[model samples]
Target: MNEEINKIRELLDKIEKKNDVSEDSLHGTFDYFELPQIIASVIDFLQPLLSPYESVIYWFLFRHSIIETADRYIRVSNSQIAQGIGSKFKSGDKVKVASDKAISDNLRCLMEKKVIVIVGDTNRDGTLYKINLPEEIELCIERMKKSRVENTCHVEQKKDLDYYNIAENRLLIFERDGYVCYKCRKQLTRFSATLDHIQPVSQGGDNSYSNLITCCLHCNSSRGAKPIMEQFTSDSKVF
Candidate 1:
């Protein structure tokens, strides 16, 4: 019995040593934040007013500037926006591809709804869009509230996957992972981090919080469709 007890104690000690090494190695690679409560409030308020396409585009821009870049204004071309939101298109011989026209239409709609504004004149480069946060859209929120009351019975329900792509969920996943890449254990900021699925969607993974993790772009792209364990072997060095 004493021999067994000593063995167990030795195993526990080894585990603690390993944990200490991990913490030391990852000391500067993770960052923690007080989750931004405003993101949730903003997304909830706007969900009712936005069409599916509008919501997708808005969220994409929100992630790019507000979350990833930490900028109030983002300069983007219609082609860029279209690509980000997975807009479909087709050439004479090719299948569906990105549509810049669709992106332009959505931008115009968002501007008309006062959810975004053009910061300057359109130039050869691209348009600079100033994204309106929750506090910045008081009037639009009021109008949306009134419209919701008027059309209470006609509310639209979106899919779970779509909901997961909103700013709020993205923030939640970032916070949950301490803003570090799960695979490489590298520290990241809102602008530099991306959410990756432990199980690839093509392999039947869903977008639940349990399935999502914050990853740096390189690790996320490199680990595509590969098993998670393959990236974290004993011989691997994150740096």
Candidate 2:
């Protein structure tokens, strides 16, 4: 009797894998605000490799699982997959769904390509599958990483000039010092604040980011060319 029961348990286990929570599903921290970039990455890197049917199914699954729900796992059956890719109903043509075998074949091909994975076995509802993003696919990772680096370098190129002379780069200094008068500890707005040199231009200061400071008009004109120390000392006494 124990042997028979053990065999039954084993069969049951084989039929239904547990629907345990997956760590990847729990990591729902991806910013959907970057959805445009993610979509672009998919178009530029992943779409070229997929066949017509695979592309359709992959996009369908992506929309339902990731875009609609913001999770990678979904429980769906072969019939549902076929129906999702139903034939067009234009001009009263009878609507027809894809065959189960065709849907199964495409899904198997995707799994072999490592674009998706079966996370749990079939049950009354459906089987659980995990959809891999472009970045997560092993085949796409190297290209995706390269694209991200190129974007970063492009942004870095914008800052490769003199900070004091360039209006955009000048704002960087004011923003860095928070648009405040450094000597007086006064808050300032963009229109009212001015950039001052710690080492006077007449002395040796060139227009680099490190040599610049934010100051109000009053502190700027009053401290002109005076040694930087005088601004900090009292008019009546020196420390």
Winning model by TM-score = 2
Best by lDDT: 2
lDDT of 2 by residue, 1-239 (tens): 99999999888776654443565463456557656665775787688768889889998888888788877788889887877875445456666677788888999988987888998877766788898766456566556445545654454455446777776566556655655678786766444568888778898876776677788889898886965755664673321
Candidate 1 clash pair list: 29-187, 68-191, 89-96, 89-97
**RMSD in order of candidates:** 23.2, 16.2
Residue runs of model 1 more than 4 Å from their true location after superposition: 1-35, 88-93, 143-239
Clashing pairs in 2: none
Candidate 2, TM-score vs. the true structure?
Answer: 0.54
TM-scores vs. true structure, each candidate: 0.43, 0.54
lDDT of 1 by residue, 1-239 (tens): 99999999799767744543422232333232422554664566675678888888888888876676555567778877776777565668776645667777877888888888876545455776777754346454464345445543332232254314776567656655556687777766555678887767888877776667788889888776965655677887643
lDDT of each: 0.65, 0.71
Q: Backbone clashes per model, in order?
A: 4, 0
At residue 91, what lDDT does model 2 achieve?
A: 54
